[model samples]
Target chain A: MTSSNNTDTRLMTGNEACAEAALVAGMRFFAGYPITPSSEIAEVLARKLPSSGGVFIQMEDEIGSIAAIIGASLAGVKAMTATSGPGFSLMQENIGYAAMTEVPVVIVNVQRGGPSTGLPTLPSQSDVMQARWGTHGDHPVIAVVPSTVYETFVWTIKAFNFSEQYRVPVIVLLDEIIAHINEKITIPAHDELAIIDRTLSSQPPESYLPYKNTPSGVPLFAGFGTGYRYHVTGLCHDETGFPSSNARIVEELYLRLNRKIDQHRNDIIEYQTLDLDDAEICIVAYGSSARSAQRAVRIARQDGIKVGLFKPFVLWPFPGEELAELTRKAKTIIVPEMNLGQIAHEVSCATRKDVVSVNRVDGTLITPQEIVKRIYDVQV
Target chain B: MSFRYEIRLSGSGGQGLILAGKILAEAAAIYDNKNATQSQSYGPEARGGSSRSEVIISDEEIDYPKAVNIDFLLCFTQEACDKYCVDIKEKGILLVDSDYVTKVPEGKFTVHKVPITTIAEKQAGKSLVANIVALGIITGLTGIVSKKAVESAVLSRVPKGTEDLNTKAFNLGIDLARELK
Candidate 1:
């Protein structure tokens, strides 16, 4: 189905749409080891990237995959990688390196059931905490969760935008169900959506401080070959980009790294709520679980249950502020996830309310009827 | 009131049921301008394990992408039919391959038995097009998706050189379903 504006509309899985969106977002380099539920992204990019004058590399492992993207991002190319749980674990060290060095790159993790190589072909949201704190240190992260195939396309582009805008690695966390489910989506025209590019330093080569803390807390980037020489390291560094062990400088470096995202949480956070105006019961969910919650909300509403759904698009900045505010009217708050209350704990901590956690990690999706039953159980 | 029709195509992994499910969803969502979601679940084995592809088509947005209360089911094997017949809605349509599904499970739904793979091999001259033939039977039985839309979706999805074979297989299955109807 084509729209009047001539935008292409066709059926695609979330993974396919994500890869296509990455190309639209101008991702010039993709380095990833093929992993189930996320392999389609690498496969698509391998065939399409070369034709688009981009590079696609199948790395030896996830560590090399993430390292390649970081290196490519340092060279001023839009770069990304995709993996599932096991691969994501191996990439954590570099994820930290990317965070400390302030590299603009996107990582798509299509989470499957896992502690380690757990269920290769099943779905899970167990990686919620991992996506947030997978890498060591007090680093700030922007991770977005897309519940639908359409949102997968939109949020992938947004992940690229947020990564470039804040000069940090952004994670796009999708579960296996969303990655595999096919739906119809209209591809927006290139000029329709806002695409953010990395900010380059216009300062003279001698005066360029790679980590210069600007008013926005984001330092301008100078690509490796851009006639600007600056030290890039994981060591605690100052505005001059040189290693510093100074007490004040170390503290300042950490604060600015966080301040950039913390100060701009309003711009980075995104969420959607439905039938919440008179909702006494609010269901907080994300990724594929949110889709089930949405159906439960509709079913409960039909029964006059006064239920609603709160779905977070940008999962990392966690939408806690909005949840705390919007859920004030909700007498009972429920968090249904594929894991064992990973995000439910966050919801409880965020709202400081007694939240009911409905979890399923047996590889099958939590059904809408199950959520509705949970709502009823709370009602009584 | 929202109108939702759920369909399930279940069989062993190598039966191409997943592709059939995709074509059905594509027909409903793309050619017919309806909202549709198609999802599949299979075991670790690449073939022979139980595999299921579900399609939920609605006039309104489909909040849940799975088929819980299936309106129609196409089972290519007895194992698939036995496992899935319990989930079919009352008065639902259940079509099975007579050659593979010898013993049909008792259900509240109407059961139509056809030699799906045999027809594909004998009529379409290939067993690989059995999935396409099943799609034809699905379209013809329930009228869940329009015939024209299914035709368009099938043509677009099949290999370029073998369009005629697929078309012949699909139409033969459609004609068979019409006779059963």
Candidate 2:
């Protein structure tokens, strides 16, 4: 039924939206073992995907889960896997391989307090840096941090698009708070949403260089069984799918797989600016914590304290340059994260402004009051 | 110019606060045609710690889905009640499991002395259904939703095998809550 007004909604969690986005993005396969805060995605997909003519498999472990999604993607299907911290760590090896082999796969890391299973239910945005450097060796990654369930829905589609277009693993960085937070969300009809198809290998089976570069810097990917017989390997290869040790070839080839996402930073970056045009203070946050910070901005505004919020939806590429520029205008900058100054360090580098961190390690969202208090505390 | 209302249900994890909020939000959104959202805490160690679900319902598109000023508060443990009592909005409704909670100080809200566990055990003959009874009571007290919505939502939600027992527990809750109202 159509909503009475545009505001009508049905209650849903961030995990549910991730699953719905995958389905709406034309994801046909899922392979994941349930993990805390992120388990519901696999569970819901298990029940929902089969009915939608998709395949869902609970793999032996996170590694296998990611491996299966890679295979599924090669077989001409959009695929994804979900995990929390420990599981995220386990899948890193495969995630690196997805980057190397240029497989279009999306990984959902619903972060909890972690070094190793530190707090399973507690929320933490510590994975902000992990999404970038956690995969090992130079790799350009596309990761999106959603502030709300609605943004979660939209970013999931964007994540899949980047994975398919750039031919690499894209991370949808979620946390315990957003992953499990249920909210009323409206899902636009299938026609209203955009679905991305992978850049297929059009070369004849024998003539295919799976790594052939296009003008846009992304090599055309060969979905398996498309009559394009080619080899795929973890080893740095030449313009071909074959393993190559040529120093120049490996350097250039490895650089481009990353450059394909890096160079298109414009298309790769997704962020939101709230009250940024005129504000004396700025709060930088992502995921569920950003939602609370937005409220803090409104509260601060009501108190005649001019404040703005900068939420980098694209967590990895991190609008560092953007923040550097914002630091020029905004007098005080406060970064509130579920972790102790994870993304703040990046903000510190990007902006010359004295970045103040309002850390929350209690496994709960950093409240608006705490943010407001931090904003004023810095000035006073 | 609509106010976004976020109701947080806090208690030790596995106390069914998450599912209770889910049922409440579902009843409000699906049954009553209102916008609602709920989120819970998760961790390997969260089972015995304070866990909460926050639901936001509004007549307009909810720009922020997190709770700000609480309209209803439910706590099953002393810590939860102690943690949230001060922040509850004026004239808000507070439902505490009186058996587990003792020495509750009066607040600016309406405090109900519902022995939810006792009612569930005595009436429905199962403690698991205490949440359902609480649901029925809240629905009746608020008058914002019809019992049919919750009934349909719960029936649509219960696992395949245990549907009948859940319905019985729900009806018992409705009766109890209606009597209180």
Q: Identify the CAPRI category of the predicted complex in candidate 2.
A: medium
lDDT of 1 by residue, B1-181 (tens): 5799999999999999988989899999998999999999998897899899999999998888999999999998889988899999999999999989999988889999999899999989999999999998888888889999999888888878999999998899889889989
Estimate, for each residue in A1-380, the C-alpha lDDT of model 2 and write its tens digit: 22435654566778888998899898989999988879989998999999999999999999899999999988889999999999999998889998898889999999888889888777888887888999789987888999788889999998998888888899999987778766667777677777788766667777878788788788777767767777889998877788989899988887787688768888788678888888788899888888788878887788788789998889877789877776578887899888889888888888877889999887767877888888789767
Chain B TM-score for each model?
0.97, 0.91
lDDT of 1 by residue, A281-318 (tens): 89999999998999999888889899998999998988
TM-score of each: 0.98, 0.91
TM-score of chain A of 2: 0.96
lDDT of 2 at A331: 82
Tell me the docking grade of candidate 1: medium
After superposition, which runs of candidate 1 have C-alpha atoms over 4 Å from their true positions? A1-5
